[model samples]
Target: MQNVTIVICNYNYGRFLAKAIDSALEQDYPATQVLVIDDGSTDGSREIIESYGGRVKALYKQNGGQVSAYNDAVNMLETEFVILLDSDDLLYGHAVSNVMRVFESGNFVKVQFRLDVIDPAGKPSGTYVPHSAAPSDCGSPLRQGWLYPSPPASGNAYRTSALKKIFPVPEADINRYGADFYAIYGVALLGAVATIPESLGAYRVHRTENSGIDFANSESNDKAPKALTKRWAILRQMARARLGIELPLSFHDFSLEKAHFCSAVYQAPFTKRWRWVSRQSHSYFRSIVGNPFWSYKKKIGTLALSSLCLLPFSALSDFAVRYIANPLARRRF
Candidate 1:
């Protein structure tokens, strides 16, 4: 392992803070430094962090959000690689050792791996496979750039030099929430990125985990416009800085996302296909229908309207899904 530094950026996650730090420090790989950048936590996090004493390097700052944490922590360390571990997540024991195996490659900014999805109690519920292939089993030489099911923050180990282009991430409204998108896309823009085929970390699913525009669903309310505005700003930055194209972005529409998913379901065999329909139907139910983000009326209205996609009529199904579900989803956003 090449003198890796795990920057466990945290905020108000005192409940799981120590576990995150311990996982990093307990890695079998030697020469691993654990740096906890606490963003003005009020939940007794300071005490737990302080308990580690000099065993872990700690930094305290006002509630400036995640971008600041990474921006500050990266500048403070000169290590070759930095893992941005979330305070609520855990690094699999072999994470550092696993990621380092592929570091010697050239023209790559980072290596993204898989993470296990765990419950709040820390029991593994399911594996977060970035693709059907395993992390170690994935990533051919030419496989790079904008990987699908994008790797979670914890599963990534970034080349510090490559990060120089991404840091001080925009300082915009959206970036204030977190820098994962900017960092990942920015690095992808800087150079090629690879993937590992192992589940190297844990991503927690809890209420505290559900905020920001990424999780924006039916409940987002008027804030959706703000989120979208910031999103456009971030997208503009990525396009200009990375692609050198004068293009900007907007929430043009997501009818295509729904259309593509529905189209795939339409082509599958009925037995297998219903599963796809049910999954997305339930997804609409959960993300919009049962979503806490939506208003009671909007939730019911969206659900009642989107359910038309399940009708036996194909044209009606396609029209309802392509036009109704997606438009309602955006309005709910």
Candidate 2:
């Protein structure tokens, strides 16, 4: 059996599918199998995968969305490690090799690498995005505390046995959110995780992409308002499911920021709206109180920032950049 199984979930990204496949086929690691699962794309994506011939194992299925494709691929993996690569993304020259080398140390439950966001023209845009690597045995995956917001599974590698236990990827149940958050959270619940500092891949950001680009479209004015409602509801659900306690306003605010961003970008709700802006602001302040793990100093600072969120006057200032801010910015102000 191969040491690593690479799974690419293809949708309508015909233009970039070939490059993604080529990158997988060119992996420096030995004993690797590339599996391309096409989710019923009419955009010539299947043709691109077919052109690769024996270079990849292609599986064509109905247009069941990304989560469904991921569940299908995860079930089929027979290798020791599994990596998820989106069709529009590219792996660095030594990505597979770097991951293999790290695995040699034998100290991780899962490892997530860095991601570089690229423009439509395929030029490097000088943006270096990084996740907090998996939190090193961070306490209580279910608590109202802080944890790395789950790394992107795109360049992530998981031990086969470790992943099978969490399989089925919950495709049918997830509405707007993808699988990574649930996957990483489950991994943390299972064991320790590690982060690789080297950036081993590029995640393409363009107008055709669903998340970032769709939110900016002209007709989505009510998008923000509806998303705010959905986000709060999801957070309550997540908190209840994971920690069994309804998170206070502060935690709700912190969690809502993430969910809101996902809905706007990934779910693409229509027309930006802000009816729940005041309520969200209150939740933001309430999240900081009594939360464990966050240092008292940090909590105090967050409380002050949450105060800003509470003010009716600060909505425009905060709401304008709320969805786009990174984790630190969101918590800090």
Candidate 3:
């Protein structure tokens, strides 16, 4: 059996830490190794990690955010494959086994699966991430500067060799929060990715004072576009340096445009929201029309949904903003 390591990174999430660790330890695969890294938590997180004893390899480090933990985890990984589990999320008992099956069947750099969204209380939210499977052929869209649909960190498994080339990601401010973005996009640039169309894990979503869960909030919506824009630039640079492929200078993804639209609609004053939404709607129309990878059905569906934003009435525009533009609002809990 191929050795696989589950690196669960924690930072003051002691409330939800044990369940994450237990999920890793309870994987059906015997060769699975569970490594829990505590990023300088003050809330008895280290104690929770230590309780696992020899069942898990526990490493405690000063608080350095998610990417830093990823760097530390990658440095110590000796397994053939690794899954970076968020301290708050979980893996199904067969997650490793399912991922191994895909890896054995193909020459893939990364294996991505769906994630069932859960509340902090661990109740089902009746939603799954990505809303669709990742395309088998990512090269075409990637070269066109479009990032295909992918789940968050816990929903991915990476080949150690591919990860070794991708990390240690630059410990810059922009690269701090979303380590999975770098891992997923970077590995796609390296080689092929296998997609498992079933949910193999659970992604916990909760609202804290600082949580970015509220997609309708202007600040949260604004940050996504900037982050995604910067993320594409960084990935483009990596592709040139590592793969010698020069990506298009302009990046266009429906998700990024959605973020911009959401931010503008929510942030703009009432009198100006219509104008801003109209502008973003035009951008969306252009994006949908220009994307060669999208099928006519998808393009028409997207274009039709975005056109609702240009409606003169706030009620209709608000409905479009909530259901169509904001991804989080589409979820039914």
Candidate 4:
């Protein structure tokens, strides 16, 4: 049996951290270790973790953010794989067993499971979204991007070796908004990824959740949209330098892929805030020209959208992003 190290970072999620840790410790999988990094939390979170006693290897550190905690915890892993579980979430009963099978098979480089959004009290809100694949049948790489279908990196599992090869984690900035997206993108560019069909966990959502708030202002709603705009730029560059290609015209058309689709994240109300629209258009054009498949029609449309994107409301394709486009991406794998 291979060893698995589960790293959970908690800031002030005192209400939920205990349950999350308890669930991890109770995994049916064998040869597992749990590491809980409390990032200078003052909200009695430390006390609750301490209650876990020797069950988990608990580390105390200043508030360097989640990535910092991840960086620190990963260094202590002698295990074969690392599972980054959020402090506010709960793993499904068989999540450990399922992940262990994939790691032990030695064929799968990474695996992401379906996720359900739960409320603060840990109850389902009647919004049960199935993952793209079931454990028995892993989905396509492109479909993996639609797993979370949201901004980035909330519900996914990775091989420690592959993760280390791409990123050591605890990255320098600690301020990265879509850090998980960057990590997942790096993994996709470098290694093969598999999708587990079963819903592996509940991604808790609430006003006070670490992810639901803006890290900088800590109170603004713009944090997510701002992070996404930056991610779009990064992906464009990665596609050019690494893949030697650009995002497809199909990628943009999919943005408005009628009645419903994922790329619509670009449509947040704040998405049309001018700053993001300008930058996204800049990246989109660069991608269109760089993509070999971009036809004359696409070139013309890209130019048209670019011009229209600059205007408010009338040219507001961003609206398509928020309402129609983003739903498919909430858990983008």
- The lowest-lDDT stretch of 10 consecutive residues in candidate 1 is 209-218
TM-score of each: 0.67, 0.71, 0.90, 0.65
lDDT (CA) per prediction: 0.64, 0.61, 0.79, 0.57
RMSD per prediction, one decimal? 10.8, 6.9, 3.0, 8.4
Q: Stretches of candidate 2 above 4 Å error?
A: 131-133, 143-147, 170-177, 207-255, 258-279, 285-333
Please identify model 4 stretches exceeding 4 Å from their true place. Answer: 128-154, 169-176, 207-221, 229-333
lDDT (tens digit, per residue) of candidate 4 on 1-333: 778888887888888888889888988887778899888999999889888888899899998776677666666667767777878887876787887777567566567666676767887644333312323222232323322232124356777765665444324463433456555655555456666655677776555322221111122344444444455455556555655645432232222122121122233344444655455444445444543334677556555644443455632545333322223223322
Tens digits of per-residue lDDT, candidate 1, 61-150, equal 999877778788878877988899999999988888877877875545788888776667897754463433322312221122112335
Which regions in candidate 3 have their CA more than 4 angstroms from the true location?
207-219, 267-274, 277-282, 290-295, 326-328, 331-333
For model 3, the run of ten residues with the poorest summed lDDT = 209-218
TM-score of 3: 0.90
Q: Comparing 2 and 4 by TM-score, which wins?
A: 2
Best by TM-score: 3
lDDT winner between 2 and 4, please give it. 2
Best lDDT among the predictions, by candidate number: 3
lDDT of 2 by residue, 1-333 (tens): 248888998888898888888888888887778999998999988778877788889889998876678778878988878788888788886888888777767666677788776666566655545533445573254344344544356767787776666555444443333555445655554566667887888877553223232322112434544544543355446546754555434223344443353343322222222334443334444445544435677678655543343244544335433434333223333
Model 3: lDDT of residue 241: 82
Per-residue lDDT of model 3, residues 49-93, tens digit only: 888889999889998878899989999999989999998999999
